[model samples]
Target: MTLFEQSGTWRPVDRAAQQVQTLSFEMPEGVTAFRVGLEFDRSGGGVLDLGCDGPHGWVGWSGGERSSVVISEEWSTPGYLPTAVSAAEWHVVVGLHEVPAAGVDYRVVVSRATAADVAAERRAQPAAPPVPERPPGRDLPAVDGMRWLAADFHAHTLHSDGALSIDELAALAVSRGLDVLAVTDHNTTSHHAHLAQVGERYGITLVPGQEVTTDRGHANAFGDIGFVDFRRPGRQWQRDVAERGGILSVNHPLGGDSCWRMELDQPTAVAEIWHSSWHALPVLRNWGGPLAWWLSWGKDTVPIGGSDFHREGSDALPGSPTTWVLCEGQDVLGGVAAGRTAVGVDPQGPVLLRVGDELMALGADGALLSTFEEGRRRIVGDRVVLPAAAGPWWLEDDHRCVLALCL
Candidate 1:
C-alpha cells in the first residue's frame, strides 16, 4: 500500500471563490484502488466544496456533505465516475465558500491499495442488517382524533453521497424509532422507486422527497411526485411541487455552507425551523437566518425539522429533533401540508401539543418550556398548563432555544 497525507492552510476566500491544493504521488506497480479523505474546519465560517482529479481527470466530488470517499476499479462514489485510477500525478480542487477572515485549514489523506488489500476490503464489507417491522408510532399521543406521527423529513442514501443504501437506511430508521423516513437525495429522485418495498419491509411510512440542492440555496420536496428539476428557479420548484401535490421546504436556511441564500418573492411552502446544524454551526456565525425569515412572513409559515441524516458516526440521527405531525391517517406529508406539526428535541423528548385552547406537553414532564405566537416568543418555566391565549405559542427552552415548536 502507498499513502500520502498532509496538512495545508487556505487563505480567506470570498463568498464564491475557488482554491486548489494539490498532492503529487507516484504509484508503484499493481496498485488496484485509490481512496481519498479530506478533513477541514467546518466551524470558523469555512466551508469547502471539493472535487479531485487523477492523471486522467475527475475522480469524485463530495460537496460539503461528505469528507471521505473510496474509488475502486469499477465503482466510485455517486456523482463521480469509477474508471481506471491510472498511476500518475493527482490534484484535489477545493471551492472555498464563506471563509472567515482568519482563513481556512484542512488535511488530506490519499491511500492506494494492492490487489490483496482490495480483495480483503471486498470481503470485509459487512452484510446488510435485517430491518424489523416498525411498531405504531412510538411514544406519540393522540390529539383531537389526530395522532402525531414521528418523521425525519430529510435524509440521504447511497444514490447520492450518503454512505448507507436504501436497505441500510431502513434498518437504521427502524432502530432509531422513526415511524416515517423521507429519503430526500441531493437533486435527484432516483431513490423514490424503491421506497415502497423498503418502507414496507421496515414497516415505516416512507416519504418520497428530493433536496433541490443548488449553489444558491437548498430545498426539500416531499411526495410521490416524479423527478424535480433542480436547475429550475426556486419559485418553479415551489410551483411544480405544489402542482404535483408534494410539499416543499427551505432547508437550513441559515446554515454555514448549505445556507439558503436565494430570494424568491413568492411565499415559501415551508421552512426547516430546527435543523441539526443549529447546534453545531460555529458559535461566531449567525444562526438565525431561517427564523428571521419565517418571522418576516409571520406564524403562518409552516415549520418542520430534519436531521439530514447521512451516517451514524456523527451525533446526528434520522430524527435527532423529531418532527411530530398531526395526521388523521398515516400520511406524514399530508400533515406537513396542513401545517399541523411541531419539532421536538428528540423522539423520546418533549413535544408541545395544542389541543383547542389548551397547551400541553406529550412525553415531557417538568421540561423547560416557552411560548411563541405572532413573531415574538417568551420563555416559560416547567409549568405544564399554559394560560388561555398563551395556548398558541411555541415551547422553547431557557435562552429561547427551540424545544418544541407548538406553532
Candidate 2:
C-alpha cells in the first residue's frame, strides 16, 4: 500500500537553498517491510542522490548510484541495511547533487510491502569467481616480525556504485595479488557485514570502510567503525573516525570535481597522494600536483595510493597503484596507523620502501630516487639501498612520471 507520495520540480535555486531535503512519512504499524523509490528527470541533466533514515538515525545512502531501495528484517538492498520494521516516522533523504538551470521534475514514492513482496524483489547474489593462484610474495625486508602487505585502500562494489558484488570484488583483489582490500562503499556500511565471510573464502583481508562523501570532498574511514556521517563537516569526520578507533584518509585530494576542497583546521594524518585519476592524463602532466599538495598539507602526513576502481574500463584496476603496508599478519589498519606504507605503480612494479634507516629501491634500475630533503640520486641497479634521510620519497622515470612513493 502506498503510504506517501510527492512530486515537485527542483531548480538550481532550490539546490542552492538546501542541498538535502527530506520527505517524511509515518511507517504504519505491523508493516513487515518498506520500499522507497525516487524518479527524476534524467534528461534534464540533473543528478539526485537517494537515501533512507529511520527514526533511529542514518539507515543508508547510495548517492546517485541507485534510484530505489527496499528494507526488511531479513534482507535489504545492497546500499541499505536490513533491520526490523518499526512503527515510527521514516524519511526519504534526497540530495540535489546537480540541478539544471531549467529545473528537473522528481517524484518519490514510499510503499509498504509484505514478506512475499520483498522476496520477489530481492536481487540474486552473483557467483564468486574462481580463485586464482597468487604470485610468490615479495622478499622485501621488514622489521623483526612485520611483513609488507600489498593493499588497495580504495575500491567499491555493488554495495555502492561498483559493478561487482562483495564476493566478486574479493576474488578480483586476490587475483590482482593484493593481500588487503579496503571495501569503501560511498556513504554506507552495508558492505561491512559480508567482508569477513567473503574475505575468508577468497584468502584475502577485506577491511571494512566507508567513503564519507559530499559535494565538497570525499574521505575514507578505515576499519570496522560504524558509518561516518557524510552530512557532518570534514573536521568532524576526522574526529568521529578517530574516536571510533578508525583512521581517516583524505582521498584523491586533487581529483577534479571530487577533490578535497573542504576546510579542516588540522590535516588528516593520512592522504591518498597517488590516485588512478592521474592515469587519465599523460604520465608527466599531473604527476606533481598530489606531491605539491602533500608538501603544503603537512610534513608528517602519511601518503597512500588508491585506484578508486569501479567498473572495468572506468578507472584503473585494483592494485594498479598498490599500497604496501608493513604490518604483522592481516593488521593492515594497524600498519596504516603507524605510517608504514609504500605505493607502487602496480603490485609487481618498481617500489621504494623504508627498511631499518635505509631506503630500498626495487625493480627501479635507471630510475631517479628523489626526495625533498635530499637531492635526486640516479638508481643504477635493480635493487639499490641508500642512507635514509627525512623523506617523502619517490621513484620517477626520466620523464618525471612517478612510479613509486614512500612515506
Candidate 3:
C-alpha cells in the first residue's frame, strides 16, 4: 500500500566537491521496508551515513550489519527497511561521513521495496530522461480586461536533475518571458543559494522550494523553505506543510501508472495539470483521460505546470503544456499565491484571462466581443455572458481572483 511511486536518480552534488551530498524525499505508505544501492569510483571510500529524520529528532541510523563505512550500506548491497510510514513527508538523508577525494563521479540509489519484492529483486526502475527546458522571453501583452503571461512551477538544474544551473534556469525563464518560476529539486534546497541570488540579480522571482518526496509519491509544497522527513509518519509531514502556510500540490498526478496517489484527496493548493511526464501520452489522453477528468471536475484543483527537468546534461525545453500566471510582477512566489494563473496545452497557443469591471474579448483576430459589462449580463452567440460580479471573482484558468471572488 505504498502511498506513491518513484523511479529516478537522486544524486544532487557534482564530482569536484569535497563533500558528498545527501538526498531525501517523502515516503509512500504501505512501504514495509526500503533498500540502498551505491556506486562509487573509489574502492576505499569514506563512510556514508544513512538514516531517517524523525519529528522529534534522529530516529534511525545505519549500524551493525546495517552500517557499512565504505560506499554502500551493510544490510544487503541494497539495505532493507521495514517500517510502515505515517501520513507525512518523511526525510531520507544520506551523508558521506568521510568521502575520499575521487576525481570521478559517484551515485547512491535508495528506493522502497516490498518484503516480497526484495526476495525477488522486484524494484521499479526510475522514469525516463527529462524533456527540453522552456525557452526564455517577455511579459504577455496586456489587454483591456485581461492580462496574459507564462509560468513554470517545477524546474531543476545541475544542482538537482536539470541540465542547466540556477543562473541558466532563471535566464531561460526571463528569456521565455515567463512571469513566475519555481525551482523544485528531488529532495533538497541546495539550489536556493544560487537561485535566490540570481532571481534578485536578474529580477526574476525564483520560488524557493523542494520536491517533498515519499517512497510512494511526491508533492511540491511551494512557498518558503520547509522540511519534511520522508522517513517519519506521513501525517506529520502534511501538518508541517500546512502549518507553515505553504501550498501543497500533487506533482504529475497521473504518473507511474497511477501508482502515485495523493495521501489526502482533494488537495488544496496545487495539482500539476501540465507536466513533461504527461506529454508521453496522447493529447486527448492528456486532459480527457479518466484521471484528468477526475482531478479536474471532481476536485476543482488549481492547475500548475512544470518542466521537471533534472538538468543532468542536455538543454531544457518545455515538453508540452505550459502554466501561465497573471501575477503582479516577476515575483514568482508572490504572484503564484495571489492566484493570477492559467494553464494552456501545447499547440493550443496562448490564453488570456481577465478579471475586470467588464467582460471583453480581444480575440487573436482583433474582434471584440462585449459579452458583459459592470453589473449587466448578456447572451452572445452560443454563450451566456455574465457581468463581472461586484464581489470576489475568479479567472478559472490562471487560478487568480478578481476583487470579489471567494477562495
Worst 10 residues of 1 by lDDT: 371-380
Q: Model 2 over residues 297-393: C-alpha lDDT tens digits?
A: 9867997888888998878999988999999877889889899999999999998999878899999999998877656889999889899876888
Error of 3 at 227 (Å): 2.0
Candidate 1, residue 396: Cα displacement in angstroms equals 3.0
Q: Which segments of model 2 are wrong by more than 4 Å?
A: 283-286
Give the winner by lDDT: 2 or 3.
2
Question: Considering lDDT, which of the candidate structures 1 and 2 is the better prediction for this target?
Answer: 2
Q: Against the hidden true structure, what lDDT does model 3 obtain?
A: 0.48
lDDT of each: 0.70, 0.88, 0.48
Question: Each candidate's TM vs. the true structure?
Answer: 0.67, 0.97, 0.54
TM-score attained by model 2: 0.97
Query: Model 1, 1-407: lDDT tens per residue?
Result: 33777777777643335343445666545566776778988788788765566676545456666686666776555534565766667776555644678877888787875556556645654466786655455555577687877888889877576888888888888887888888988755557767898888877888888787776788998887865655568888888887888888888887766777776757675788788877654561234555566677566777788988877887488888788888988967778887788887778777776665766665554445543434543434433555446322555444555567666
Q: What is the lDDT of candidate 1?
A: 0.70
Per-structure clash totals for the candidates: 3, 0, 58
